[model samples]
Target chain A: MNPPSGNAGAPLLEFDRVTVRFTDVVALEDVSFRIRPGETRILMGAAGSGKTVLLKTAMGLDRAASGRVVLMGEDITRRPETELFDLRSKVGMLFQESALFDSMTIAQNVAYPLLNQKAIKMEREKMEPAVRDSLRFVELEQTMERYPSELSGGMRRRVAIARAVVTKPPLLLYDSPTAGLDPITAHTIMALIIKERDVDNTTAVVVTYRYQDGNLVANFRYNPNSGRLDPVGSQGTNTIFMVLRDGRLAFEGAQAELEASSDPYIRKFVKRPERDAA
Target chain B: MLDVLKGPVQAVQGFFELTGRAIRNVIAKPLYLNDIFLQMDSIGVGSIPIVLLTGTFTGGIMALQLGRELQQYGQTDQTGTAVSIILVRELGPVLTAVMMAGRNSSGIASELGSMKVTEQIDAMRALGTDPVKKLVTPRMLATNIMLPCLTVIDDFIGMVGGWVIGMIVYNLQSLRYWTTTWQALGWSDVVQGLLKPFVFSFVISLVGCYFGLNTTGGTQGVGRSTTQAVVVAAVSIFVIDLFLGKIFVSGQRGL
Candidate 1:
């Protein structure tokens, strides 16, 4: 597979023959996937199709019972928790519920990873600027001092995105970024995600169910000026991977290929349910 | 025969698993130092007043009862000695352990248990942090260190209780009471009483944290673990006390 633009060199992370088992259930089976240095990879799956487990394995939260998780060319499947900490510092996660610490304000939540960072000795001095920058990235600069409970769901998600990206990690993992949001708010969040990747060249692995038809069609257009294939239009063109039921790779291609796909699963995923189906 | 063999086999397996986890945790990072310090503040510092109050009252009651019994036999002078021996050798450590099992052990178990059920432990792991180091180790170290210190404090307060009852209530001379107590209580008794706490602390903390870390089924599991921790710790302390007493008694006869 051709590497995405802005990811000119080698792949930054890859899961080779990864298999995650939870007792009798196999969450992910023989899953092989890769994300380059600065590409956004979408992982699409139904509720229990193991999207969350796949993300957990990459984050080193779940052990790949039999395979290898290669990050920066280092096989980190069985690394010690301490070593995994260093690896995790280079990646950020935005959980489905935002998972903002209820006890902390938005600013404190954003500064949490920085506080845990062993590299930052002068925590008090460095914390404010980091929090400000992160909040600014998600356009949530004003709500820094407010608690998570005080914020709306959309605002909380943005705060979570801010916290996740605060560390300025090269890789970002987002779980259901637009699951419970109005279309406008979801679009706003998607735009912010696109902006972050374009401006900072950060690699994003987004797991979401919302697949806009217009966005998919526009993503197929090749930009001759940049010499890159845009997946979800020029505004957000990154690699996409879809996982289906029964441990099947339902779709694996650019936005163009996915838009043109005739597979029933892919069609069902991309198309809006008709009035009869609804 | 089958039941008997099955019980022993299961017990052995549990012991090995517990031992393996502890060893793995110790070798993992030694990150429990700060956590242990914080836990010491919670378990030892917080429980001081209650343990002291209970220890003192129990000692006073024992002294009063013993004094009444000895007075009938015209052996009233031995009341202080008897009270002191009981308080120092057994009652002080055992009572304090039970008190802490109710107060500190239950709290630790429930708090950690709730955090486990809520996916906070999973979050910690996802962040590339060891939950054992961050949550369990400090608690274990804190309870182990603080329980002994609390036992010593309880012993002192208990002795004071006996003195107050003997001198004021029973009209016994303070000097005579002190002399009898000092003569009857040897360094061996103190050492044996103190020794039990160090072992009891380890047992209480290990059991409390183990139950907390393994808790599931949500709020109900947290509640269940808390109750179980107290019962287990209290029972284990008594068992350890009996064995320690036998060892001391045997050693003294040999000496």
Candidate 2:
């Protein structure tokens, strides 16, 4: 079969048979998927099923032992880190643990990316507005001077989101952004993600265990006219679902198609409604 | 048997690899000089009290023991010369490095290890900053510069402690004791004292970073890395001193 293509042009991210291994454990095997520009792809999987590994692989944080990763129209599977800098500048990744620098205050954490851009050494005055804007975007503006250790779990995740998007990167990768949050906080984070997608036309790949959250992400579209999210059509082109089982791609399609899949593991995954995914 | 050797061999290779990367980053852009200054203050200033105590105690003890031993042969006057030579030639660099190996090496390992386990290092990379340059380089450079400076202070304080003991305990004339000590210290002794700490600092920094970057298994893994950093750095201090001591000894004999 031919590789997947975008509706407008080349796919923004394409994983052609990517495989990763750590000793005897196979983190990913023959994994393949594509996410087009401005499209949100939700990666669904059970624990140890390669959900987080796939996300890391896309960002070049984990090297694939075989196959290719085509990112931003460039094959970066084996590229050296120096060459990946420009590509990474266009991509923002939020880790599973809300990995804010513990020693830095919330503002410094948010401004780190902008200040480190191509080693340009940005001045504090220039960095202040961007940091303030990102903090306000995450609704954590009042906690700008607090260190990561001082923030609550949910607050740290929000700050992580702010830091990820502080530089206005076009592609956002979120690894379980709502994993440990309360319902209200999770909803808020999900809303902010959709807002980013709508306002910035940001393409994103989210790793999630909650099928309901994934459904909410895949089925909703933000309408600026009403300032509210509305459900997309049954055949919406904005979102896609990719499911993995035992480190291989088991299913990749719309939410309807996923619920209809006959594979027992896929069926089991669809059966569980509000469970946590790895 | 091969496996036993392999661990050390791989560790040595890893140390060299990190050192090479750190040096390249030193010459690269975005040096993170702020972190360098912060570390210099922390490692240099934070350590002054302990180093001071160690220096004074060590110097007084060296003079006291030497004075007693030499008096058995009616050579008590040589105690000051002996203490100055040992302090400048060996004790200053070795003791200061051992203290750093215990303090700064473990600190670096635990900090990096925690960052590794928590994904902050990975996040830094995703943000377009290199962890080696942003995190490790500043620390390595700071400790490298400060270790030598501390050794000089240790040596100077040690000489003064020896002077107190020489005058009060041994009853050596103050003028004679100072003259002999000054005469005993050649440029070679100063070079040896500085050179050892400079090299020892590299070993401590590189080993600490290696274990920290490779940390796994969780918080337990961080503890393991920290312990490994201190043990390896401390042992390496002695091992390196032994080899470097031989080199200086042979050179002196040849001269």
Candidate 3:
């Protein structure tokens, strides 16, 4: 069944009445949403609002206690972990804290998915260029030999981005991609997210607290020729804004609808365009 | 009453579940040989010096103590029989296992706890690698292999320590000491020594992995898991040693 929120053509990710529980705690309660091919979703929520849980649930990292999650047209809910690997390789995820392997060099971190993802079988000779190209996409090719601890926080996130997209999967999930960065660095990370979207035509779901990060994603398009993010007019991006409140989806619509939201909790996240200009 | 019993019961269930999966992964496909070797270096090779030092001191102290007791009966020359039996049948396996419980169990818990808290383990799952296959099984296998090897070395080095004491303090004949030490061990004692370590390896590695994977609350939680892993594994070693020793002693007595 098609979700009312998404555009036409089969959904890339669809959560049908999914509820995730941890013993007595209701992490996600009957949450359902849909994202069609090439659509971008900006998920905003307060701390402990089940945002990360939703992302993990979508990835099949955490199984749904009830209902079903369909990813790329496959029913993933209750699928055994062994079977999930092949399905997970078709998606890329950037964790909240970067989650780079501390023991591995940046190159190894980026190369991990390529080497380990059972579906992506590239020879050793071809692997290095893919690793280098992935790092180059983040503009950090020179730091390949360095460990995650040696890099700055923003650099590590970028390296994480490089790792996430190295496989060039059809869908990318960024959990708080700009969560802990300075304003300028957050912008850079958002710009990279947009660039990946525009370049690969990849579907994305970005979880963030910063309304500006969502705004940038909604209103900006990356220009490959200029190597910069260009401000786009109304129809340039197919961005859906979602607000999660206490384990339930409170809002799901376009930027205008999100800004027009009257809910106080939702308003706390919407930073209206007047402030965006200031 | 059931509420009070629930947490520990679930913990035991979860631990066995983890142990079952880890062992099954031993024969499962996609074996991570590199990870296994890396863990071998970390758990096995890295443990050598501490094992050697502790073994020497423990053996030396046992010889000193046993030699004094034998001197009471004018049987100082029989120090080899007492020392070798105690070291092989009890001290070697128990002491080495306790040391590993302290060194490797806490190390595994803290390392994996940090990974867990940082979401690296989740990331590992997302990247199409089973964290248990990649992390826990390798550690389990490495500990299983290494603990026995370390125990043997401890047993041999301990005997050397006993001989050292015989030569210096007791002024006992080297040939007689060596002969008694060699003949002191029966096949049962050897099996018991090796068997205890193999069993203890499972306790040490699985306890560490259990506490680590279950760690919550972030950094402080890592510390708690580390402490719990060490304590649980060490206490378990002694507890299991008592039972195993009882069974072996019973068998020898034809009970």
- Candidate 1: what's its TM-score on chain B? 0.90
RMSD of each: 5.4, 2.7, 1.7
Q: What is the TM-score of chain A alone in each candidate?
A: 0.85, 0.91, 0.96
Preferred candidate (TM-score higher): 1 or 3:
3
- How much is the TM-score of the A chain of model 1? 0.85
Better candidate by TM-score, 1 or 2: 2
lDDT of 3 by residue, A64-174 (tens): 999999999999998999899999998999999999999999999999999898899778899999999999999999999999999999999999999999999999999
Which residues of candidate 3, in runs, are more than 4 Å off?
A1-6, A274-278
Fraction of native Cα contacts reproduced by each candidate: 0.29, 0.80, 0.95
Question: Any runs in candidate 1 off by more than 4 Å, and if so which?
Answer: A1-8, A100-108, A118-124, A139-157, A178-191, A209-236, A244-251, A254-278, B1-36, B64-72, B163-178
Q: Which clashing pairs does model 1 show?
A: A219-A233, A231-A237, B36-B138
List interface RMSDs for the candidates, in order: 2.3, 0.9, 0.4
Worst 10 residues of 1 chain A by lDDT: A213-222
List residue ranges in candidate 2 displaced over 4 A.
A1-6, A119-126, A223-228, A233-237, A271-278, B1-8
Tens-digit lDDT track of model 1 for B1-255: 897698557655764575466646766654667666778898889999998899899878888899999999988899778988898889988899889888877887888787777555665665545667767667767877788888888877887788899888788888888888889999898898888887787777777777787687889999998998888878888998999999999998999
Which structure is stronger by DockQ: 2 or 3?
A: 3
Find the candidate with the highest DockQ and give its number.
Answer: 3
Question: Candidate 2's residue-wise lDDT over A116-209, tens digit each?
Answer: 7774356778789888988887789999988999999889999999989988888999999889898878877887788788888899998887
